[model samples]
Target: MKQDIPAVKQPVRSKILVVDDEPRIRDACRMVLSEQGFEVALAADGNEGVQMIQQEHFDVILVDLMMPVLSGFEVLSHVREAHPDTVVIVITGYATLEHSINAMKRGAFDFIPKPFTPDQLRAVVAKAIKYNRALQDIADTNSRLRTMVNRLTDGVMATDRDRRIVLANPAFLHLIGYHGESVLGRLIDEIHVSDQVREMIGQTLTMPSDEFTEPTEEIACSDDSGERIVRAKCAPFRGRDGSTIGTITVLNDITALKEFDRIRSDFVSMVCHEVRSPMNSMMMQIKVLLDGLAGELTDKQREILGRVSEKMSGLTTMVSELLDLSRLESGLIANEKSAVKMNEILREQVSFHAENGRRKNITIELRQPESLPPVLANQRNMEEVITNLVTNAIKYSPENTTVTVTATVENEYVRLSVQDQGYGIGADDLKRIFDRFYRVNDQNTRTIVGTGLGLAIVKSIVEAHHGSIKVSSTPGSGSTFTVLLPLVSI
Candidate 1:
């Protein structure tokens, strides 16, 4: 079969304008540029050149310095003011150093002496043509980028090192509730926005150039409609030399997602509450039968009932954890807080888990300075955090291994870390360990009893207290969970 070949498109010819008082010079330049595949136009004087420029766009303009009606300097000024992208070249009979410098200072791309050869004209025009094309390309790219950003729904903004707004799309202005036409060059602090957003941007602006961490936060914004949740992410913007120049922030509306999450958490809470009551009653009745309060039973009957009780207990524990998590998600937990001595909390958790560790033949160690700064935290919530971490450490570690709990002061925060010599998590599993009901599915973990809501609850509590939690692990070595809480201000 004969396939049809696609036609190749020819490159567009560059347009050139020659403006001179001399008729012969105009004709000769036009003929030369036309022969070089440029669309050429002829103008008699500087006034004629300006008229032609107004009529149409030209890639390059060759104007004579000494002309009637208007000087080349005037035409250069017009081109620079009106069509800054158009390349201007000067032609002069008086080709002195001063003339060339003045022409250049007036924005001329290059100048050629009047008594010149065809090759010299071609060389200078060729250079101007190349420069003009590059400028056009850059302008086109910038236009396209602006169009794309303007049409986006997500808000995008950029700031300079001085925290002045350098670029912003219409969406950004709308998101920030700004009614002005432009905010360029205005200080970011002048804009009305949530302090959380401003603080995030400030952090990115002050971050080390070598660090490319992007900080993200979900903040609530109120308007006529209602309260809207916006997720703002900020990162350091670097220059060509890899130095931090400013910051870029992107805002996305996530109000619907947050509402959906609230609905889901409420539903889970209801379900857990209803299930827990009946489960507890059934467990109580089962215990009665197993204790021979109702009647004596055979060995097999007792064994079956025991197994059922065990399964029921597991289910009950899962329900309780789910309810706790739901409450955390609904912002009903951790409401009451005060200055808490973290060292005391650490000591209490270690002592509480010491018996369990000894039953498994594992050692529990506590390491801390005599005195430590207190953290602003809920006493019950902090106790839960320490209990969950220590219990997990002891549960995961093998016999004869040691679990270490440490507390230290880090800047304005208190650092609590629990290290365990256990079957560590894989990289893929580590990312989602804090997600609700997410459990590692390895063989070693299959034997471990967990509702998988412990870490999720820990994370929620930490964040509610304006703190952070981090985990690091190796495959066979162990895992370490670290929490940082702001210290109680004096």
Candidate 2:
């Protein structure tokens, strides 16, 4: 049996209508446009072309001037009124200055002479289509951008290199305490907070071409109430000839975040003081009982008491650390600067840690140069700095492993280092090791124990002494903690 098959029709192409009195010109134009994938229709006169345009949709129309019945001007006007988007190109055999001008005035896209080549017609037609398409694309993109800019909550402002505001979002207007009408075309310094910002703007603008290419850093500006921090990014804008004509800047406000941090720090200090008062009294009572000032007890009872005392001691230390950290962050812990011997301080700290080191079977080595500079620091703060680092070294290190405590003068500063051969800090914890209540290791369970304030207190004390502390470690190779103290008042 034979099977029946159906033929499929190709999709219709874009339509083009040709209106000319000359039969040869119309035929030639139709043949060229038809070969170039346009569905072509021919009209003998201007009236016929207008009738065709009114009846059907055409993407482009080629009309001839000086027609027999109704002139090309009549057809052009009628098509433009009825089908506004249909491109109208006038074709004239006897080209005249007045005729070409009239066609353009009547909204004709282009006027082609009779002697024009097929390639010329094709190029002009393609260019006109591309131009219209590009214009439509730009309109659509602009509509979307305007909608987005209006909807955004953050302030956004774009300025030319001349520092004049070009475009600004509603958020930007609100942030700078202004409205659109007040800000446009105004220099940045006009709305800028103070003399400092005005100077910064001037400096940045006057910067050599090389430096201005990079983004501006985070800047702080003082407003009516307080300071506001904002991150600013800048990029050079170039013109059609690719020369840097201006710059664009984006500002993001971070004032609320900074204020929140300050409030949190104050609350922590209040809580730490409350907790420290009670813990200090409790530890004092425990110390009295352990010293036998309360009464006598058996060896086993004393041993049990000793363990309890040790744990209480840990709690007391934690409370002290909390107080120290709170004081440091709140800026309440100012250094009581004094010119004191760094070596004498180190020897005393090492001697104190040596007692604890002996129980762990760890060797404590003190390396200090005899002629050491007197560091400008509070004695108590520097002592705590030494004690915390040395105590940490003892805790993490194994039996008989060496803990080296060294103090030496370098570059008008006293450098104290505690080097330990122990389980070193993990890579992830290195950056935040000094943050309060942050600890490294599975040994950080409340049972395995720490108030997690050791490094934090150490950091606070070092800073209070007008010093900086740094720690470097490897997973197995062990760690080195260094404190740098200025030799003179700073």
Candidate 3:
């Protein structure tokens, strides 16, 4: 069985072009490179090399400096301008330091002296091949990323530390209504964007490199189409060394979501309004029956009616709280503002809740500086804020505990705190305590009666008055709720 087997062909590693006036040198390069599995082509002079390059693509180009028609320097310049990806190496008898420097400056990858061995040529070519591949990989990755960003629906933009726009996608240009030819290297302030977005970016850029907090805001933008709501989020952009070098802003159009929220709030308000009148009438009728105006009632009948009345009262309170939340969301409550003495409001709330605290043997104490500054706020709303906090404190605390209310001036703002010795909230429940209808479920809080809307309404009112609220709690210890409101300019 002596059957002859055909030889298998190996794929060429690279395509190389050798251009020289000397026929012996040109032939020698072709033989050496061909033996190393490279597809090699020869040229008599620089003119022939350039013509072959124009006709086809080559991975590496080897040229001699002392060419007859066109010099290697000319070929290097042409390759740099036309096919920059192609690696060019210079081979010459005049391999002096000056000639090597000149060749390098002209964009030659590396220099090889005349009478070079095959190993020397292979080593230099291998290094050039590795570098060239790395550059190609980077270019490919950048191209893919740009394509992905351009096709996204959300807008993405990046700026340098100097506030100059470095990268902006097509979606960002459309969102900002920019029809300019280019936006690169332009200052963010010069661009026709919303002031809120510019401020967010500016703040993020100026933040310390160690701290990373993304600032987000809903901005109104108007263009030829119409006015729309855009939610812009800005964060610090960090470099390889983990230092912030710039800022990035991502924008999403939320016009539809906002419209949906408005519609939902309107529906809820209408339903609450219609049910409120009928519910009030029912409550009055129940009160009259309890008073024996309809007829004389037995103890069992009275107790049953009392339970009904209590449930009705809870429902009425829930309805009212929902209505208040609607009004706050609609900005109706924020319209009424005046110079209000927070200390006076605190005194009135403490006195009002005194009896409720006494029933549980809990003391409601107020500590305030004598001459506290007045805050620009709605008096009735501020009173509600105090009422809710004091009521919660008294309701949640054990018998004979004290709920201390304090007011102090803190740097152009009035700091109000309501500290309660109660079954403190756990770390998990503290996060959503201000959310509507969210109640902490546990044994200590099970018997307590509440609509779970007090803290939510308080938070809405506080934010509407340009104030802030925060809470700190430790399990089984106590909780402190603090409010900070800016003082009115005297």
Best by TM-score: 1
Tens digit of lDDT per residue, candidate 1, span 9-61? Answer: 99999999999999999988988889999999999998989999988889999
The segments of candidate 1 whose C-alpha lies over 4 angstroms from its true place after superposition are 1-10, 94-97, 272-490
Q: RMSD for all candidates, in order, please.
A: 10.4, 15.3, 12.5
lDDT of 2 at 251: 56
Who is ahead in TM-score, 1 or 3?
Answer: 1
Backbone N/Cα/C clashes per model: 0, 2, 0
Best by lDDT: 1
Better of 1 and 2 by TM-score: 1
- TM-score, model 2 to reference: 0.40
Clash pairs for candidate 1: none
Q: Give the Cα lDDT of each candidate.
A: 0.87, 0.74, 0.86
User: Whole-model lDDT, candidate 3?
Assistant: 0.86
For residues 1-490, could you state the per-residue lDDT of candidate 3 as single tens digits? 8988998886547888998899998898888888878889998998988888888888889999988769999988888887898988999899899999999998998989998998998888888777777877888999999899889999999899899999899889899998887889999988878888888888877766544556777778888889888878787778877677888888888777678767977888788778888888999999999999999999999999888888888888898888777667655221435557887888889999999999999999999988787787777889889999999999889998999999999998899999999999999999999999988889999878789999999998888768899999997888999999987542
Single out the weakest 10-residue window by summed lDDT for candidate 3: 330-339
What TM-score does structure 1 among the candidates reach?
A: 0.60
* TM-scores for all predictions: 0.60, 0.40, 0.56
Q: Candidate 1: global Cα-lDDT?
A: 0.87
lDDT (0-100) at residue 427 of candidate 3?
95
Q: Please, what are the lDDT tens digits per residue for candidate 2 over residues 280-338?
A: 78778767877889998778877887788778777767766665666666443324345
